[model samples]
Target: MIPQSHPKLHRSEFTLGVLAGGSGIRAGRRDKGLMIAKGRTLLERTLERYGKGFEEVVTCCRDNAWFYSRFSSRVLCDVEPGQGPLQGLSALLAATQTQYLAVIPCDQYSLPLDWFERLSSALSSTVIGVFATDGGTHTPCCVLHRDVHSQVNALLKQGKRSLMALYECEGLAHMAVPGAGMDIDHTDALHGVIRKPPQ
Candidate 1:
């Protein structure tokens, strides 16, 4: 977009992949992304955030395949099935050609728009993923260079899937992003943390 077309959207070279699928044991099986938050559904607010970032936003929501149709391009189904967020990330890498890939959890109450730029500027190469950390624990919510696809594919090929394992690579950079690492795992847990996102 020419920025003027959508002044609220931020333009970036990275493709923002939002991971929104998985049985919602936390949200009581009511499709966590679609669960009413504040007033707007989490899904709606998430698409808007990413829509402003990359040229496109691809959502990996298995249950809500059509949920993103309301938005423009940038949303697509994950090519692989039954795999967790790691698999979803792997699938995302497989479909993208951008030099950088960002994986986001759609359940967050709010995320900073400058997130991709901050993480990208910190890491020098695609060999590592820039993760959000606190204390010293690596938060799986992160962004990585496109170069990890080969390693990620191999892991999925072996029937092994987990977001944390992808960071075991030699040059992975796990840095903390202040409060960006917090996630809304359950409604009660989300209670006073995130703002009422726009619908």
Candidate 2:
């Protein structure tokens, strides 16, 4: 169930992370981060949304040293392979110096503007974190406490890779947001989101 509205929390205590590690199987193996829309890459667009709103902004990628050269700093490479978002989450969690992390997909550009504030306020000792979106509890849009890092590592060691699996951990909560399913997964999906270039 989605948690009730709570007071805003300090942004300095949480790290904002973007999971851009997709192999792009649905999008023809292209790096979704680099996909262009509205004269900007998806990663660029995502950063514009939450980059300045947190203590730090980091990107979790896979074997993409080129991405580092392209973006410079704040880009973290996945230590393990073939683990999907699990690997990205591990990388993000490890790189985060803050007590909490808020992760959103590179393709999920239309999230509520107040997402971080809402999720941050919902966290507490008993509630490790609250993931936004009631449509799917396992969607990449979620927040987590640094305390769960060990559990995530344990799951990784067990060869378990998938955000849905991570969500099953105890003490996590969910937040429902209206109009939450605007992620762009395929090429055609872009037409509905991206605007045409100036005439």
Candidate 3:
């Protein structure tokens, strides 16, 4: 069933929270968001997914927001330094005016355009949160009800940065995303996004 058909929720009211808060330490403090593989910045590539996937597209970055001007006002960086992604989730959640929000990482550039269709089909009103999976729960890729306040807030108050803990929400479900599960750890991240590897 579509979220629009839910008795309490509507698709138009949902928000897409694109979490891009990391310092890109994995890529040697090189500003992973600005990293270019195929002439497109990682931030720009990631935005393309949500720009087409959801009604609201927001990027949570550090300080430099001008590079993302094409996305302009919709782009937001961390207000309090070193607060971590879980901490930033609250701020992004507050920025939206909806009951349903999908939290996806900027590292996933391989996400399919039809990804949301699978998410909507796996979700209904009762589920509190759901993750996009290829075979198991894609820890970094998840969707949740805005009411995640109580649990997420409590974790934030305690200063636990791990988002996997947030999956403890009531009735967590999983939705398969196929080729969309790729993560940009090294240079190989780009290989999966546009090419089909040999058998």
lDDT of each candidate versus the true structure = 0.64, 0.73, 0.66
> Candidate 3 residues 1-199, lDDT tens each?
6346544434455687777777766666656667786787777766665455367666677766776556634778787868777776787777767777777777676667656555666666677767777656355566677777667788888877765666665666776776556667666456654443211
Best by lDDT: 2
| lDDT tens per residue, model 2, 81-123 | 5568877888888888887888888777666677777776778
Over 85-167, each residue of candidate 1 has an lDDT whose tens digit, in order, gives 67777767776767667777776655566666566666653336677665565555677767777878887777777656766
* Cα-based TM-score, every candidate: 0.79, 0.84, 0.79
Higher-scoring candidate on lDDT, 1 or 3: 3
lDDT of 1: 0.64
- Cα deviation of 107, candidate 2, in Å: 1.5
Q: Count the backbone clashes (under 3 Å) in each candidate.
A: 2, 0, 0
lDDT comparing candidate 2 with the true structure: 0.73
RMSD of each: 6.7, 4.7, 4.1
Better of 1 and 2 by TM-score: 2
Model 2 Cα shift for residue 129 (angstroms)? 1.8
